[model samples]
Target: MIYLQLFIVFFQIGLFSIGGGLAAIPLIQEQIVDTHAWLSISEFTDLITIAQMTPGPIAINSATFIGIRLAGFAGAVVATLAFITPSVILVMTLAYIYNRHKQLDAVQALLNSLKPAIVAFIASAGISILQTALVDTSQLPGAPFDYVALVLFILAFICLRKTKFDPILIMLSTGLVGGMIYLIL
Candidate 1:
């Protein structure tokens, strides 16, 4: 039953996520945190930090991490397979069709519709991350509310608005600040 659930849950993510692994974060959170109750919100935040530190796709790292935490080695294997299989199939099929019908109206329409869905998926992912990262200003946790986090978020936003700095650098700096805030105090 657990294996089946893992497959179906990740299969849904694969089917819907248009952009890629980062865009799959909301679905991962929905399954691992909200639906399965497999990890605490804090743990999920930590797992995301760990995932970013690693060298692969964030979604794959998350599936493996969360699955192992939930049900050990076998769970990681099942979850990893579930996360990739549908996506592989869909991408292969789409590539074949796109090669054959590069000028078709339906293909063009599909690509057009895909743009907004991908944006929506990424937006959903951002919202899920925000839910874990932000604390209610009313309820302080030990080290006062993270004004530093808010400032970093604003700085990242401004940098994105004006400059063309690499996004990975922004994330790394924020992660560093977050780690310092969580650990130092």
Candidate 2:
């Protein structure tokens, strides 16, 4: 039953996560965190961090992590396969159609129309994660904000926007600083 549920959930995530892995974050959060209650918000945030730091697509990474956490290796296999199956099928089909229709204005227009929605999905995911990182919502009216997180976020944003430094370097530097701060205090 759990395997079946995992398949169905990840399959749906893959099928509708049209803008790629970043776009899948909200859907993953909805189904895994809100619907299944398999993980708390903090766990989901950590999952996102680990997923981003790893090599694969975020959605696939998330599927593997959640599946293994819930049901071990076999569950990881089922969830990962289910999450990618739709993308494989869709990409193959779409490649054929796109090649055939590459010159059509309607096709170009359709592609252009999707850009805004994709931006929205990415922004929504960013804001959700930023909120989680910056504030402890569980404490409600008097929750203390994470000033250190805010400072790191601003510095990272500036570095990305204004400098040619590799993003991985920025992340590693910030992670090191943040870890030290937390360890010391």
Candidate 3:
């Protein structure tokens, strides 16, 4: 039953999350955090962080992590497979269509039209994560903001935009600094 549920959830995520992993974050959060209550917002935030840091795509990584948390290795396999199945089918079909009609103006227009929606999805995901990272939403009425996180976020953004530094370096440096700050306070 749990395995079935896992498969259904992740399969839906794969089917509808059209703009790739970053854009899938909100859907993932909705299913895992809101619908299932399998993970809290903080846990979802951690999951996203771990998913980003890991090798694979975020959606697949999230499925594996949530599956293991819920029902162990077999669950992980089921969730991972379910999450990828739609993408595999869709890509193959789309690839064939695209190759056949590569020069069609309508096809190009359709593709171009999807770009804005994808950007919106990514931005929504980023805002959600940023809220979780910077503000204590659990403390609602007068939640204290994490200044350290804001500083790190700004610095990371600046580094990526202006310095051409590897993202991993920024992440590691901020992570280390955040850890030290937390330890001291």
Task: Please give the RMSD to the true structure for each candidate, in Å.
Answer: 9.8, 8.7, 8.9
Tell me each candidate's TM-score. 0.51, 0.56, 0.56
Per-residue accuracy of model 3 over 1-185 as CA lDDT, tens digit each: 99999999999999999888988889999999999998999988997899889998888898899899889999999999999999899899989999999799999999899999999999999999999999999999899999999998998999999997899999999999999999999
Q: What is the lDDT of candidate 3?
A: 0.93
Question: What order do you get sorting by lDDT, best first?
Answer: 2, 3, 1
The better candidate by TM-score, 1 or 3, is 3
In model 2, the runs with Cα more than 4 Å from the true position are 1-87
TM-score of 1: 0.51
RMSD of 3: 8.9
Look at candidate 3 and give me any clashing residue pairs.
Answer: none
Which is the winner by TM-score between candidate 1 and candidate 2?
2
* Residue 5 CA displacement from its true place in model 2, Å: 19
Can you list the residue pairs that collide in candidate 2? none
* Per-residue C-alpha lDDT of model 1 across residues 13-101, encoded as one tens digit per residue: 76777787888888888877898887888999999889878989998898888778776898888888888888789789989989999
